[model samples]
Target: MTKVDFYLLTSHQPQIRERFACKLTEKAYRLGHRVHIQVEDQSQAQKMDDLLWTFRQGSFVPHALMDTEGAAETPVLIGYEGEPGAGMELLINLCREVPQFFSHFPRVAEIIDQDENNRHAGRQRYRDYRDQGCSLETHQLSI
Candidate 1:
C-alpha cells in the first residue's frame, strides 16, 4: 500500500504551494528519490519547472518537463498528463483531483493551502485514500 501525506499550509496563496513543492522536491531529491510533480495542466507544469529552478536562492533541484528530452534521466519531473515514468518513487500532486496513477508511487504528497476549494478537495482526497486502504498522514505547515 502506498503512503499519502497531506501538507496543510496556513496561507491561501497559490505561490506558497509551489514554493513548498519546490522544497519538498529538493528534499526528496537530496535523499535520492525520483519525484514526479503532477500539476493541473501544461501551464502549471511549466510554471513548476521554472519555479523549481529559482524558488530559493543558492539552491538547485535538477528537474525537467515530462515531454522534454533527457527528462527520464533527471531526478525530478513535472507533468500534467500521462504516466509518471519508470522508477519514480515519490509523487507530489498539485492538482485538485486525485491522480489516477498516484498509487503507482510508494509515497504521495498532496499540498493543500488554505483556499476553500483546496480544503474541500483535500478532504475528499483524504477520504478517498483511506477508503483505498492506504496509509495516510498530515502535516500542518506554518508560513
Candidate 2:
C-alpha cells in the first residue's frame, strides 16, 4: 500500500505550494530517494523545473524535465504525463486530481494551500485515498 501525505499550507498563494514542493523534493533527494513531481501540464512542469533551480539562495537540487535526455539519471524529475522510470520512491502530486500512477510509488505527497478550490480538491483526494485503503496522514504547515 502506498503512504499518502497531505501537506496543508496557511497561505493560498500558488507559489508557496511550488516552493514547498521544491523543498520536499530536495529533502527526499538528499535522503537518497528518487522523487517524481507530477504537475498539471507542460507549463506547470516547466515552471516547477525552473523553480527547483532557484527556489532558494545558495541551494541546488538536481532535476530535469521528464522528456529531456538524461532524465533517468537524475534523482528528481518533473512531469505532467507518462510513467516515471523504475526506482522512483516518491511521487509529489501538483495535479488537481489523483494521479493514475500514484500507487506505483511507495510515498505520495499532495500539497494543498488555502485556496478554496484547492481545499475542496484536496478533501476529495483525501477521501478518495482513504476509500481506496491507502495509509494516509496530514501535516499542517505554517509557511
Which ranges of candidate 2 are over 4 A from the true structure? none
Best by lDDT: 2
TM-score of each: 0.96, 0.97
lDDT of 1 by residue, 48-112 (tens): 98899899998889999998999989999999989877899999999988898888999999999
RMSD of 1: 0.9
What's model 2's overall lDDT? 0.92
Worst 10 residues of 2 by lDDT: 11-20
The per-model lDDT (C-alpha) reads 0.92, 0.92
